[model samples]
Every structure is written in C-alpha cells, then in structure tokens.
Target chain A: MELKGRAHKFGNDVNTDYIISGRHKFKTLDMNELAKYVMEDLDPDFYSKITSGDFIVAGSNFGCGSSREQAPQAIKCAGIGAVLAKSFARIFYRNAINIGLPVVECDTDAISAGDELAVDLSKGIIKNLTQGREIAVKPLPEVMITILNDGGLPAHFRKHGTFNL
Target chain B: MGKTIAEKILSRHSGTETYANEIAVAGLDFVMGQDGTSPLAIRAFNDMGGEKVFDSSKIAMVIDHSAPSPLEGVSALHKLMREFAADKGIKLYDIGCGVCHQLMPEQGHVVSGDLVIGADSHTCSYGAINVFSTGVGSTDLAAGMISGKLWFKVPETFKFQINGKLGRGVYSKDLILYLIGDVTADGATYMAAEYVGEAIDNLSVEARFTISNMAIEMGAKAGLMRADAKTEAWLKAHSDRVSQPVEADPDAVYAKVKEYDASRIGPQVARPHTVDNVSPIEEVEGTLIQQAMLGTCTNGRLEDLIIAAEIVRGKKISPDVRFIVAPSSRQVYLEAMNRGVIQALVEAGAAVVTPGCGPCVGTHNGVPSDGENVISTANRNFKGRMGNNRAFVYLGSPATVAASALNGKITDPRRYVR
Candidate 1:
C-alpha cells in the first residue's frame, strides 16, 4: 500500500498525554471527536493546522507513555495518513497497527515539517516529493503487512477467523 | 538452548519451545480490563463477533480509573461494564476496590508462572510475583477474551543483577528510578527484564511489586524475578491456586547482563515531562511544589503509607501545599486504617481519598491547575499526567514526597528519615 501526505514534525518523546490529554478521554469515546484534540497539548492550534492526508515525522520514542488506544485512534482519525518516527513505544506501535494506523520507524531528522512525501509499505521506500530524495525504511514483516492491508486487527479478524493466530 | 524465565513460561503455556522474536499463541491464565480500557475491549470484542466469553472465571474487570464516576459519561461507561460483567459472569471489581494491578494480585487472581494479559500497560505488575504478564491493546485483549489465547512475539531477556544493601532514605522506588534513568525509557523496548541480586532477594513483596509495576516505563514487556520461598509464602497466603513456580535455566541466553552496586545509588526522581529525564534528589532539590500526591499501583501499598506516616507523623505540611494519599487497594486501605497509617497521614493534613488511581491518570481528584508543580510517588511524570498540560510533575519516592510535602518544596528524603 502507498500513502502520500504532507509532513508534521514533532520532537522526541511525544507522549500520549501530549497526543490527546486524559482530560479529553471520557468526553466521548468516539475516535473522530478525540481526533480533534490530537497533539492539542503540544500544539493548541493542532486541529486547525492539521489537514487530511498529512503525515507526522517524529524523533525517537514517539507515543512513549500510557497504553491508551485513544492515542493512536485519535491520530488515525485526525486524518493523518501515517506516522514516521525514529522509534515508537512498543504498545503504541502495536495499537497503531491494530487500529490500521501505519507507523514506520525510520530516520525522520532529514524530513522537515510540511514536506510532501509518499510512503510504500511493501517496498520500504519513502519519497520526499518536496526535496526530491528517496529514503529507505525497513519493510514491516509479512504478517504485519497483512494486518495493515486488511485495515487493522478487527478487519483482519473479520476477514480471517479470530483464532487464526 | 537454556531458556530465560519468559521463554520457560511461554513455552510451557504454548506446549512448544519458544525463543526470542518467534511468534506464538499463548494461553492465558487470566485476562483483565479496567474501566479505562474495558470499554474499548468490549467494543472490539463485539466487532470481532465474540459470543459468550471464552472463560468467565478467568476474565476480570476492574473500575478504578474513573471510580466514583466523576462525570455522567464515566458513570455510563461503568454501567456498560456492569451490564457486560453481569451478562458474562466475569468478576467485576467495583469502585473503591483499588487499582486493577494491585487488586489482581492481592485478590489472588495471579500465580507464579501464569500467563496473564491486561488492557492496561501496567499489567506487568503481575511480573513482580513471577508471573509472565504483559500489556495489550483492546483488539488483542478482545481476541484473548474470545479465544482464551493471544499472540506474542517472544522478547529477548535483559538480566539485571545487583549487589549490596541500599543506603538510608533509599527504597525500591529509588532503585528502579535510578535503573530506569541509566537504561533510558526505551532501553528495554520489546524485551523482558529479569531482576536478580541480593538486594532484590532481600526486598519485601510490596517492594518487589513497586519495582515491577514501573517496568512498563522502561519499555519492558515484563519485569521478572525468581520465585523463592518469599514468593511461595505470599502466594500461599493470598491465593488458593496451586502451581509450581517456574525458573530460568542457569545457562539461559540473555541479550545483555547488567550489574549494579545497590549501595552506591541515592534518592532519585524522574523530572517533569519524561520518566527518563531523571536526576538525583540533591540535584533537583529546593524546586517549589504546590501539590504532593502519594498513591497509585506503583507506591500506594501499606509499606509506602507507613513511610509517609513515619515522615509526617508529628509535622504539619506546608500551609500552601496540598497532600493527597490514596491506597493502592481496598485491602491496603483497610489494613492502613487498622494500623492507624491513615489517621497519622490525616493528622499531618493529608486528604485521604478512596483506594484507587486518584489523579494518577489525570481522571479525577487532585488535578493540578495550569503552571502548578507536583511531587508524587506515583509513576509517570509525563506532560498532562496530573490533569494539566502546563503543570510540572516530579516523580520521587514516598519518602521524598512526604518530606517535600512538609517543606512545600522538593527536598531530599534523607533529611526527614532521621
């Protein structure tokens, strides 16, 4: 699958609380509503600044605190296409994929904010359209690719059996 | 090849030899979801077409995140959980039952070598008692609930061995904070950490729980220790489930081995915004604080309460400070009351609340205002953890929090100990 988007830049250790503060958690469990607050703490104007089909490039250890599924769900529902980080916390990485949110680990320092980029999951290539450069990323495992292709775990489980694993 | 503790446990559960990075389906001894995550898990379960729960007896749900139902929305979520629990016959821990991690082990739902999974990240708390416990998201938890099994990518093991006794005013909280500071937050990502040493062996069960509970902050899948006579005694007293304890082979392969001299460690704290952003108490001392919180699954045990009470028994907290104490579990609350720990804290001007998470998740109770600073015993000082994004949170030992509460500023715990 290929994803193209503008880049939103975040620094190291952008935690869950920063992604969507817990205060906004129970206001509604709806992902779209929660998406309106993604990165609200870090950027109060995040909602107004973000556009659909945009991607985020972050330094190391993005999504570093809490196992809140809302963190990734909010990001995905916020219209961000995928998140490219130097690294992601384990639970966050898993939750993003489970919810069909694409998160790739690659060197993001070279990618600046607002760069238009295209990511190819199967081939592990990211094209910087704005900069005319190509960056390589480690392709996800075949099984993970299958999950992403099916649009997250629920869809994967529906298409396949829940017990297929 | 010799197996690590995680490998040994997973292999036995799966009835197949498992190694690092190998994906396998592991049968669970217990499956859990708290109010914060259960709603999501329930939704996923429905989407995955789950019928009756795979094992009602093995499933557990707790309502501690928004206990007392701070708002109508949370109350409705609680109602939904209650209905689901009643329909499925799953065990439900209602409000005031304490945090899920503390309640699970205290209620005897966990046993050595058992494979447990919870929707909350701190589920690794069970690893303190030598269980193979890890955190999963709602979808993974739903699949486990429906099938009584979940997928795992076996993690490599990091062995931490420490020697010598800790210094005065230092506790397991300090030890863990110091270790995490050294390893950094992502040092153990996707790995299993096994604690072994004279120091760990000498710690009480509650102290062990404190260390393992924060394992998630270090990015470990599970923090493990060898189950010994102490473990056996605790389990026998608390649990009716009988299972032989599992142990790692002496020659087990490990990703790395780290050795430490516990005697050299000092009081520590994880400063605001990042747990890995740690510094010695002396280095960050004298920083002002408006609130001092002492509770949560991490440090709200009876032992922690005792330390807080000891420090503040005769002194009044600074008039400008707000000190709050919430026990980790109902049993702890009852025991603290029976032991007069609660009264002593109250006499020192502490506001003792119900036994639950209590503002640790920024959900309810004692939320800081914008620009306020806090010293807390609970784990995680990430931005907005205490309800306000602009606030600063300093993570410290119960001793440090208690001392700082009295001073109205960050103070080294050692001064009050004597």
Candidate 2:
C-alpha cells in the first residue's frame, strides 16, 4: 500500500495520553468523534491539519502509557497509513496491529512531514515520494505479516479458522 | 530438552516447544478484560460480522475502569457489558468483584499456570501467581470471543532476586517504582519477570500483585513469582477450586538476572508522563497536589489500606485536596471495614469507593481539573490522564498518597512518621 503525504515526526516516548488526554474521553461519545481531537491536546493545530495517509515517524517508545485502546483506534481511524517508530510501547503496538492499522518500526532518521512517502510492505521499503528518497525497514515477520495483511487478528481469524499449531 | 515454569505453561497452551520468542498458534483457555476496551470491542464485534462467542465460560469481563464511570460512554459501556453478559450467559462482574486481575484470581477463574489473555495491558497481573498471561488488542479480543483461541510469543525471562527486608516507609510500590528508575521504561520488552528472593517469599500476595501489575511499565511480557503459602492462603479464601501451585524448578534457566537490596530502598514516585521518571518522595516535596487517590488493582489491597489508615487515623485531609480510596475487591472492602480501618479513613475525610481499577484509567470520580496536581496510589500518571491535560499525576505508595492527602501537597511520608 502506498501512502502519499508529509511525514510528521515526533521524538521517543510520545505517549497515548499526549495524543488524546484520557480526561477528554468524557466529552466525546464515540471514537470517530474522538479522532478529531487526536494529538490536539499536545499540539493545538494538530487536528485541523493532519490528513489521510500521513505517516507518523518517531524516535523510540512511541505510544507509551495506559492500555487505552483509543490511542491506536484514534490514530488509525484518522487514516494514518503507517506508524514507523524506532520502537513502540507493547500495548500500543499490539493495539495498532489488531485494529488493522499499519505500524512499522524502523531506524530513526530525518524523515519529516511534507516528504511524501510510499510504504511498500512487500519490498520492506519506505520511499519518500516527494524527496525521491528511500529508506529500508525490516519486513514484518511471517506471523505478524499474516495478522497485518488479514486486517487485524479478528479479521484474520474470521477469514481462516484457527491456524493449526 | 528443558523448560522453565513459564515456558512449560506457554508451550502447553501454544506452539510445541517452538521458536524463541515466537508462537505458532493455539486455542485460548481464558479471556479476561476490564471496562476500558470491552464496550468498543463488542461494538467492533457486531460491526465485523462476529456473531457469538466460541464459549461463554472461556470469557470473563470486569468493570475496573470508572468504578463509577467518571464519564458517560465508559459508564454506558459498563452497563452495556453487564446487559450483554447477562443476555449471553457470559460471566461478568461489576465493581462488585474488584479489578479484573483481582477478581480473576478471587473468583477462581485464573488458576496458576493457566494461559490467560486480557484486553487490558495489566492482564499480566495474573502472572504473579504463575499464570502465563498476556495483554491483547480489543479486536483480537472480539475475534477470540467467537474463536476460543489466540497466539503468543515465547517470552524471555528476567529474574529479579531480592534480599533484605524493606526499610521503614518503603513498600512494594516503592520497589517497583525504583525498578522502573533503574531499568528505564522499555527495559524488559517482551520479557517475563520471575521474582526470586527472601523478600519476595516473605511478602503478601497483594504486594506481589503490585509488582506483577506494573511489569508492563518495564515493557515486560509479564511479571511473576512462584506461588507459595501466601498465594495458597489467598486462593483458599478467594477460590472455591481445589488448590494447586505452580513453581519454578530449582534448575530453571533465565534470560537475565538482576539483584536489589531492599534495605536501601525508600518510598519513590513515578513522575508525570512516564513511569521511569522516578524520584524520591522527598525530592518531589511541595509538588502542589490537588487530588490524592489511594486505591486500584495496583495498591488497593488490605495492607495498602492499613498503611493509609495508620497515616490518616487522626489527621484530616486538606480541604483543598480530594482524597478517594478505592479498594480492589469486595473482600478487601469488607476486610477493611471489619478491621475498623474504614472508620479511621472516613474520619480523615476520605471518600471510599468500591473495589476496582477506577480513577487510574482516567475515569471519573477522581479526575483532577485543569492545572490540578494529583498524587495517587494507582499506576501510570501520563499527561492528561487525570482530568485535564494541564493536570499532573504523580504516582506514589499509599503512605505517600495518604500523607499528600492530609497536607494537600506532595509531602513525603517521613514527616508523618510517628
């Protein structure tokens, strides 16, 4: 899948609470509405500008903190094609993959928004569509690849009844 | 040719002696969850063409978030889950039982060596009693609802050996907070921790639970210790099943070993926004506190209350502070009441609530207003987790939280020591 957009970069440990203050959960009824305020609390202009297919590239430990499922749901629902961080919090990583959100972990570099990038899961490469630059990331392992391609664990199971161990 | 207790449990429920840190696939034995993810997962389940669960007995749900629902959807989610469970013949618990993991063991649903998967990250809490537990995604949970199985990765084990008794004012929460400081946030990624020490054997199940519950903060697959007499006693009172224990063999191999001296420990707190940003309770003194909550699956046990009650027995909470104590279970609640500890707490101006993982999940009842500062006995105090983005949450022991409640600021427990 190709995602063409500016890359918005963040440092390591960009936690779930920073994306959406858990306190504001009271104000919003559903996750769809909540996605509008994603990352708005940390950066006020984040909600208005963030568009579809924009990759969120981070340094390390992206999506740290409470196991709030909304953290990933909001990000994926907002149409992020892939989240390529140096690393991910355990819960956030699982939550993203389970929700069918494309999340990859790659080496840290100077990839920023407006550098339109195309993510090739097959070739394990992230091509900067705008800058015409390309960076390679490790391909997803076979099992995880199955989960991602199948559109999350639930969908995968639905398509293929329990994979015999 | 060989296996540890965790390896044996994982293998039994997963791939046959498979790849390192990887599992092939297998059926699920138990699925557990709290209020945070169940509602939305059920919604997703319906949206995803998921009809019925594979089996009702294989699933268990609890309302630990928002014991009183600090907000609407979360509360409605709990109510919806209750109705759904009742409608589907699924076993469900409200604030009536306590936190998911607490009630899990209390209700005899999660036995030692059982493979339990939960929607909440802290589902690893079951590992303290030797269960091979892991946290799963909500959608995966929905799929597991209909299909009674899930996959897992074999986890490397990190063994923490403890020696010496804790010094005055230090407790298990402090020990975990200290470990976070030493190891950093991503220290134990994909690693299960097994505690082995004289101190570990001597501690109560509740204290051990506190340790295991926070394993995620260290990026661990799960934290655990061999079940001992303390676990047996706790199970006898809570579980109706014939008791069994899961312990590590004397020759079990571990990935890494870390050691700590308990006597050198002091009460510590995880500063806002990160569990690893730990500092001594004395260092953060005068950190203006607006709320002090003393309870959760992490620190809401009876011993935690006893420590809080002793601190607040005669002193009154500051008028400026909102102090809430939430026990983790009905049994803990009843136990606290029968011991006259409840009277001391109530007299000290603390509002007591039911047993569950309330407030800590950022649910209402103790949500701090904007610009407020919170000192809590719960886990995780990331920005905006309380009520407002401006609100600050500082994690501490019951002793620190209790003292902070009395003074309305982040005061160390040392000053309150008699």
Candidate 3:
C-alpha cells in the first residue's frame, strides 16, 4: 500500500499511560472520545494540532507499560495513517495490528515533526518528500498484510471465519 | 528438530509442528480479562455477534484493577462486566479477589502445558508455573473467547542460564531488575525467555514467579521455565486437574543463550519513570520516600508478606512514611493472617488493605501526590502510573520496601535480612 502524510513526533518510551491516561478512562470508552485525549498529558494541544493522514514517528518502546488496547484504538481513530517507531512493547505491537493500525519499526531519527513523507509498504520505502530522502523499512509479513488489508482481525474474521483449533 | 519450551507447548496445542516466527493457531486452555480490559473485550465480542462464550468454564473475568470501583466510570464498567459474566456464565472474580495474575494460579485456572492468554500484559506471570501465557488486546481476547483459539507467531527462545547462589540481600526482584537493566526494555521484544540453571532451579516457585512475571519489562512475549519436579509438585498441590507437564526437547535449539552469575548480584531497584532504568540499591540509598507499598502480583504472596513481616517485627515505620500492605489474594491474606504476618505489619504502622491490586494502576488507595517518592513491590515505574506524574516510584523487593518504610528512605535490605 502507498501512503503519504505529515509526521507527528514523540520521544522514546511514550507509554500507554501517556497515550491515553487511565484517569480519562473512567469518563468514556468511545474511540473518538478517547482520541480527543490522546497525548494530552504530554502536549495539551495535541488534538488541535493533528489532521487526518498525519503519521506518528517515535523513538524506542513507543507503547511500553500497560496492556490497554485503548491506546492504539485512540491513535487509529484519531486519524493517524501509521506509526513509525524504533521499537514497540510486544503487547502494544500486537494490539495495534489486531486493530488494523499500521505500525512500522523503522529508524525514525531523520524524520522530524510536520515533515511531508510518502511510504510505499509494497516497495518497503519511506520517502521523505520534504528532505528528498528514501529509507527502507521491513515490510509486514503477508499474513499481517492480509489482516491489515481487511481492516483488522475483526473484519478479517467476519470475511474468512473464526480461527479455531 | 527439537523445540523450545514455548514452541513445544504451541506445537502441542496447534496439533502440528511449529517453528519460531511461524504463524499458527492454538487452542486456548484459559482466557481471561480484568475489569479494565473485559469491558472492551465484551464490547468486541458482542460486536462480532457472539451469543455465548466458546467455553464459559475456561473463561474468567477479574475485577481487581479498580476493585470496588473507586470511580463512577470504573463502577459502570464493573457493572457491565458483572452482567456479561452472569449472562455468559463465565467465572467471575469480584472485588477484593486479588490481582488477576496471582489469582489465576492460586485458583488453578492456569497450569503447566496450557496455552493461556489474558488482556493484562502481566498475564505472562503464569509462565512462572510452566504455562505458555502471553498478553493480548481486548479484541484478540474476544476472538479467543468466541473461537477457543488464537493466532500466534511462535517466538524464538532466549535461553538464560543463571548460576551462583543468591547473596543475602539479593532476591528474585533484584535479579530481574538487574537482567532488565542489562537488556533494556525492548531487548527481548517478541521473543520467549527460557530461564535455566542451578540458581533458577534452587529458587522457590514464588521467586520464579517473580522473575517470570517481570519478563515483560524486557518486552518478552513470555518468560518460561521448564516444568520440573518443582513444577509438578506445585501443580499437584494447587490444581485438581491431572495433566502432564510440557518440557523442551533435550537438544532444543535456542535463538540465543546468555549466562549470568547470580551470587555477584546485590539488591537492585528500578529508578523512577521506567522499569529498565535500574541501579544498585546502594546508589539510590538514603533517597527519601513518603510511601512504601508492599504488594501486587509481583511480591504479594505468603512468602513475600512473611519476608516483610520479618523485617518489621517489633519495629516501627517512620512517622513520615505511609506503609501500605496488600496481600495478593484472599487466600494469601488469610494464610498470612493465620501465620501472624498481618499482625507484624499492622503493629509496625503498616496499613493492610484489601487483597487486590491496590494503588498499582493509580486508580485507588495510597496514590502518591506530586513530588512524593514511593518505593513499591509492583512492576512498572512509569510516569503517572501511580497517579501523579510528578511522583517518583522506585521498584524494589518486598524486603527493600519494608526496610525503606522503617527509615523513610531507601535502605539496603540486606541489613534487615541478616
């Protein structure tokens, strides 16, 4: 798949609590509602600053601590096209893919906030349109690509059938 | 080809040969969700037109994250879980039941050779007992609930060979902290960790549980130990089910192997804001603390409480410190009480709370205010995890917490232990 977006930057170890603090969880579970509070603790004006098709570029362990899938759901519903991080916590990585949120493990050091970029997952290329540079990233396996193509496991299950042993 | 412990268990459940990094479906032996995650799982399950649970007997919901509902929203979520449990006939563990990780093993919901999954990241705690337990998202858990099976990309195993006897001050918590500090948080992402060697073999099941429980700190998919006589005995004592333990093949190939000298390790702690930001206890000694929490699935068992009680026996906590003790489960609480551990702690000015995950998620009971320093036995020292973002949390062993409670500063646990 081909995608283009502006980068939204975050630092290393941007944990689940910072993604969407548990304090707001008491108020609602609505994805959009939770989206409104994403990264509010880190940057109060995060929601106002974001637009559809924006991508998040973060340092290592982007979704560390806590197993709240709400963290990824909020990010995906907030209109993020994809997330490129140095690494991810295992559970958060799985949670993101299960919810059809495209997360890439790539060296995001050269990417800056608001930098225009085009990513071609099919070609394993992340083109920095603003800087005129292209970086290679590992593409998702076919099984995962198929799941993401169907908009996550739920939709995939609806189409194919439940996986049973 | 021989298989690692994780691969063996996955292969067994998948009813086919499995290899590292290969995607396969395995039947689940137990699937669980807590109050925080169950609401979302239930929502996903309902959205998928799930009329009944795949197997109610094998499914469970624990209300421990925000037990007794500190907030109205949490209570509302609890209500939803209660209704769902009743309607689906799934096992329900209500408020004060204890942390899901501790309660699962104590109640025999998880056993050796089982493929268990839960919505809580710490669900990997069951790996201490030789089970292939891993964490999943709510939707993944929902799918597991509906289909009794889940997908996995079998992880390569990192074999950890531990040798040397533990020093007087050293404990499982300290050893795990040292390991995590060396490896960093993302070092083991998407991999299985198989702990072996004389030191691991000599450790108690509780201590092993503590080690395996913190594997997630290094981003491991699961921390596993081979099922030996100790595992079989523990399972026989705790579970009524007759099942064979799973073991790795004699020549199982490991992705990587590393060795450590356990005796060289001293008391350790994870400094504020991140679990892998670790230091020797001496480096952070004398740092003042306002709260000392001794509980959670990590160190809330009977052995841990006894260790705390032994330190606090006939002693008083600092006037500036608020020492809180939370037993892991009702069974643990009752056992400690019967053994006089509760009396020792309470007599030393420690507040004994309900047998649940109190103050771990920052939801209820003993949350630290801004600028407050807290020493705790629970895992995860992330910013704002214990309520205020400004509060500094230091992760340590129960003995370390107890010793620090007495002095209102981080003190060496060895002094008290000796």
lDDT of 3 by residue, B150-178 (tens): 98999999888999989896889999999
Worst 10-residue lDDT window for candidate 2 chain B reads B18-27
Number of the top DockQ candidate: 1
Each candidate: what lDDT?
0.89, 0.78, 0.88
Model 2: TM-score, first chain: 0.89
RMSD, candidate 2, Å: 2.3
What TM-score fits each model?
Answer: 0.98, 0.94, 0.97
Tens-place lDDT per residue, model 2, A4-32, is: 66688777778777776665543344777
DockQ of each: 0.67, 0.55, 0.64
Determine which window of 10 residues in candidate 3 chain B has minimal summed lDDT.
B241-250
Candidate 1 vs candidate 2: which has greater DockQ?
1
| Regions more than 4 Å wrong, model 3 | A121-124
What is the C-alpha RMSD, rounded to one decimal, of candidate 3?
1.6
- Model 2's lDDT to the true fold? 0.78
* Cα deviation of A78, candidate 2, in Å: 1.2
**Of candidates 2 and 1, the better by lDDT:** 1
Which residue segments of model 2 deviate by more than 4 Å?
Answer: A24-29, A129-132, A163-165, B69-76, B242-244, B249-253, B415-418
Candidate 1 lDDT by residue in tens digits, B1-418: 9999999999988889999889877899999998888888889888977778889999999999888889988888899899999999999999999999998888999999999999989999888889999988788888888889887888999998989988899999999999999998888988999999999999999899989998888889999988989999999889999866788898899998999999999999899888888998888999999999999989999999999999999789999899999998989999999999999999999998888875898898999999999999988988888888889999999999999999999999899887
